[model samples]
Target: MIAYRNAIQLGDWIVTTDNSGGIGEKMDDLVAVPDQITARFATRVALLEQWAAGAEPVAVLLHNFSGNASWHRYCEGIRDVFDEIGITMPPISGSSETNMSLRQSAVAVTLMGKQKLESSESTGDWYTYGTPLVGEEVLTKESEIASLTVLDEARRTGLIQRLWPVGSSGVLAEWRAATGNPDCDAASPLDVTCSAGPATVVLLQIDKEKLPNAKRHFGTLLHALR
Candidate 1:
């Protein structure tokens, strides 16, 4: 199974989570990235997860594992997201890794919501909204991964047939999961293999006829499955 997914199917509703790791640890010697950014980071992923699951968010859960000392600070970040959206912060819960003097930091946020994604009767062609970036690239090109502005516009426009977030397994793995076709290989214009630790990019399934909608949102960044 793909390690990172937009959301998992569960009846009419769905569940999803998005988390950040070494970035926060690296950004904050105090524990995690400024909690507000952490909150946004988690919420952003959760939103994509919700869309991938084909639903809307209802509840939330967080695993604030970025060392114990700055737990409250981390939470403040999460709260900032909910407040900005004008939605009551869902009933929240989390854990802090205390007692262990871990040198690095990590954090996880989960969201639960409802909506049927789509019928599985037919799967569409695969495309990518953004190119893959990981490791040092994720750090160097921080703005690209951090913002979901493009994704939000695409989702709101309802331009694509389906959506999935690229994760640790990278684009190639996610494409296989979506199409269930092994032996799928070709020189790709996009880096199909990179761990998008926090789902920095999304997997888009759109037919060629609707390519314009995809293009309007993603511009030259769009990559088709070869």
Candidate 2:
């Protein structure tokens, strides 16, 4: 499916859902992970998805696979993100795998937001934000996943035409699906072969002339796409 901003835009609001897979087993190995750490990452992904739709988050819904883990810890994780970003979180609710025990933990996070389409700007060239991170990299390098801005800078810059969070399918895949250009060159200045899993990185479409200004917010993380 076409991802990020394009796949979500519905009327004046955008809703996006992201999944953090195999929690407590692969990505969420309790031994190496903290209770709120995964929750922060999960919350970040939800925000990015909402931002991609040019919207500010209004609510969050989670679908968790219990797998012997505490639902309270997961909720606390999401709460941590709200505290850090200084936004009162909306109602949070979802179903858990209470019927059966599982070997691994997982979560499906959904975020809802509203965007004023009437104030939208013109479109621009497509670019990828942050580096591609997938597979073992996602788990091994947890710091990279939630280390970017939550949309304040992007909105202020007024350069970002739109955004697409690179998920398990990676940057190249999401780009093709979003733009659908058969001749869309995959060769990029940054690594595009990895998967971000949740939303470690994203596809940013912006005007070429404003490329320099984008760095003011994204720093060295932004990669240009031809």
Off by over 4 Å in 1: 1-8, 20-39, 67-69, 79-91, 95-102, 116-118
Error in Å for residue 53 of model 2: 1.4
What are the Cα lDDT values of the candidates?
Answer: 0.67, 0.67
Q: State every prediction's TM-score relative to the real structure.
A: 0.76, 0.79
lDDT comparing candidate 2 with the true structure: 0.67
TM-score of 2: 0.79
For model 1, what is the alpha-carbon lDDT of residue 42?
A: 67
In model 1, which residue pairs have backbone atoms overlapping below 3 Å?
35-77, 36-77
lDDT of 2 by residue, 15-78 (tens): 8766665554445354345545566677777787666665777778878775436567878888
Candidate 1 global TM-score: 0.76
lDDT of model 2 at position 40: 64
